[model samples]
Target chain A: MSAALAVEGLTVGYAGAPVLDGLALAVAPGEVVALLGANGAGKTTLLRALSGLTAPRAGRVLLDGADLSDLSVEDRARRGLAQVPEGRSVVTELTVDENLHLGALWCHPGRAARRVAVARTYDLFEPLARRRSSLGHQLSGGERQMLALGRALLARPRVLLLDEPSLGLAPRVVSQLMGVLRATARETGLTVLLAEQNVTSALSIADRGVVLSLGAVVVDAPAAELADDPALRHAYLGF
Target chain B: MDRLVFLLATGLARGLVVALFALSLVIVWRAARLVNFAQAAVATVAVFAAFAVTGATGSFWAGLAAALLTGAAVNAAVERGLVRRVPQGSPLPGMIVAIGLVMVLQSALGIAFGPRHRPMAAPFDERPFVVGGVPLLSPYDLFVLTVALALVGLLAWLFNGTTLGLQLRASAAAPEVSRLLGVRVPRMVTLGWALSGAVAALAALLLVPTELGLNAHSADLLFVHAFTVAVLGGLDSPTGALIGGVLVGVLVSLVTGYLGAGVAPLAVLALLTLVLLVRPAGIFAAAQVRAA
Candidate 1:
């Protein structure tokens, strides 16, 4: 009934030290929200909290207005919230096709519909489609990223969370893949929340951009304005 | 020629038992990514349990089922309590645990059943028949062969068809990613151990009846054979383990018949050593298994 995602006053850490303190953001259906922050900025932690991978001591994450604090990681995924987890999320031993199929494993009863979603995932990442027989260990980094994306999309999530899609990729490959992601968002009407170190590229596709310095939200504005804001860009993004 | 046929048939059946045990290793390797030095120990425990239960109840099927369940339950508890807590823990730790299990299980059996060998009930009552005057074995071979084949088929279907199976594969391949995806990595890991125990029990149930009695020495020998088969085939490839088991079984039988009876286990170990020298990754190693 409400937005696809809403995080209010989130605070999380592994030990006692807080990494993400009072962080907040929300995105409606079909919206693209870019979370831009430097290293150690708790962007990854915030994403983890939202997907129910980590328990936050404070604040709430609402997925379609449902509080996801108590849901297990699998339960959150089952509720149509999927994350393209960092650093080789694709099961390296499984073939590309198997990884894609497992993405829909989160789809419990609507599994048949999720199969259609898997087919769409293959269609979305044609390189993965071609090398369907390859395992994650056998894939190139770009192919691995595409495979990771395909795996997440199979869940048919309303909100697709990507952690640094552009990381370790060539500029051309990153731009090309980013375009595909943006197109998928427009065509599928799926809201996307991506945390990126690539400021210029993220702003190119995002409707709105949120900047974080340390753990708190420092800037939330129109993507174009944030991109052009010299003061914010120089101070936080190093762009 | 008749003598040769007799030896081959006997050896082949023996090999089938080894192959099934090797299959247990394969299941463990696929799920836990550990070679499970304790597989033989688990199998030995199950065999003893089966003998005790079958002797008391006088029903083979009931006893066998109980043994397999015990194996699963024991392995599940161990994985959840002892093994699963250590993430990406080395295979060495598992091997150590397995070695420790050998002592504990052996001591427990010794206390309960005594150090002396105990006679076990044979699953089949059929005697070997002379078919076409050539000493064809009792078709008990047929039953064992069929069960092992069915288990293989079931595993293939489970890995290929079921969602839980996919999660299991994913968890083994990438624990961190699987965690992020919301899979209880520990739960899948526990399931892996349960699988290892179940398969080990099944293998032991099929195997123990072929011999005169159940003893720790015999169980330890079975582990050596299964381990050789697992290593020879490629730790990750279940099919390879099966082939390796059969090959070792037949080879050992032939050598014992012609050369010497005492050197068969050594021969199998030599063969596995050769395999390792050639391809340390294993003949049928999966990508992740090879990478590791």
Candidate 2:
């Protein structure tokens, strides 16, 4: 089958500093792929390139089967391209309900229907549902992550691009979040391509794994196979 | 008792004017986190337009319309041309440029109109009524009060209800986020400046009849009153600005009516200093912006 999301020959930089240089990767439909790399390995940069927040120097980032190059950020969002940015990207001044409404801003067929969709996301992440009245600023680190995940899902994207979902969380919270991710992918067939630093947990939940070294993919294999390979573990996962 | 009452009554009337001026200040601040220090000068330019047009036609309505239109046009031009040039520059530079523009605007108006006092007809009648066996107030005072209240309500609704208002509020709270969300942030700022200019013009239009007269000096010190209102109300809230305006107006009127007219600015300056030292947010300021 054709790849659900693909990045080929991606080149991106900031202020003349080339962070991601001619990188390539792909994720099949309904698959969960973990992008594992060390800090400064252009992990976050690649995700940003995919989201159109960072303009690539040269590359093609495909969503489903279409090119996402010409679309504006909000336009890209309306077309079901959602990015739960590294730092929990929540609107602090807005109430949680208002933030959720913003997530469904593009789901224009019917807001009542979208509200039901948001409610499902709430059910998936019960902690976020409980704190539905709270402000984004008031949520704890773990709660913020759940809220971020919940928000991205509300956009109802074909494939969800999550950057560093496991950052600054308890071990159990990370596992719980991973479980939610795995379940969402299995049931919803929502393609997911995540860049993360939490090696063990990401590999545990993901079906496949891609390791980056100096902005180039060095290894791509089945998650279970990579976990058992000791040599690959030391280079990328520090295991 | 009579001295106290007269001072208080006079102060109260002028307080309404102060309130209108303050409301204008707050409206601009809310939309763009920058203080259009040039607003006072812009108002002067707008009032000049009002004086000439009304003075020529001897029609208060004509002058008022002319003044407001001119304010909007000037505001639009400045925002699109000058302000847009330095859209994301440091605040201090923007402020300096505003002050410089004030001098330029004043000079431009002076060159065109000359330093002259022109007669402007009052929008309302000169009849006074007896209340408490004293000349309580004239129809003119009533008219000012009505105008102030109406402008406040209209703007309040505009800011809260309209799409323009939503864009302004969203832009004010988070410019980057709004831009990322595909809002044309520059257009929002332009609209905000135009709104502030129009309101300032409205305030000036009311003032030129009696206390302000038709000179360039007309509403020159009016800005001081506006600043007091804004500071008193808490810089963030429009409602606060209105209350501040009325408070300053009444306080100034009372002081001038009883003690002396010259001490009003001093009293306002003192009050603002107190509020800053104590509350620092007006009556409603939020967490201070720091170097991030």
Best by lDDT: 1
Cα deviation at B169, candidate 2, in Å, is: 3.0
Model 2 agreement with the true structure over A202-229: per-residue lDDT tens digits:
9998899999987888899999999899
Scored by CA lDDT, what does every candidate get? 0.80, 0.77
Q: Model 2, range B60-169, lDDT digits (tens) per residue?
A: 78888888988877877877777667755677766777888888988887787778877667867756576777666678878888888888788878866544565576
TM-score winner: 1
Q: Give the TM-score, chain B only, in order for the candidates.
A: 0.91, 0.91
Share of native interface contacts recovered by each model: 0.62, 0.15
Query: Candidate 1's residue-wise lDDT over A8-125, tens digit each?
Result: 9898875457898778888888999999889988888888888877789899999989898888877787788888877667677888877777766655346676667777777777
Local accuracy of candidate 1 as per-residue lDDT tens digits, B52-165: 788788899888888888889888877777666555556777767767877887788788778777777566654777888888567677677778888878877877678888
* Candidates 1 onward: DockQ, in order: 0.50, 0.27
Q: Is the docking of candidate 2 incorrect, acceptable, medium or high quality?
A: acceptable
TM-score of each: 0.88, 0.82
Residue pairs with clashing backbones, model 2: B11-B250, B11-B253, B15-B249, B19-B245, B234-B282
Clashes of each: 2, 5
Cα misplacement distance, residue B134 of candidate 1 (Å): 3.9
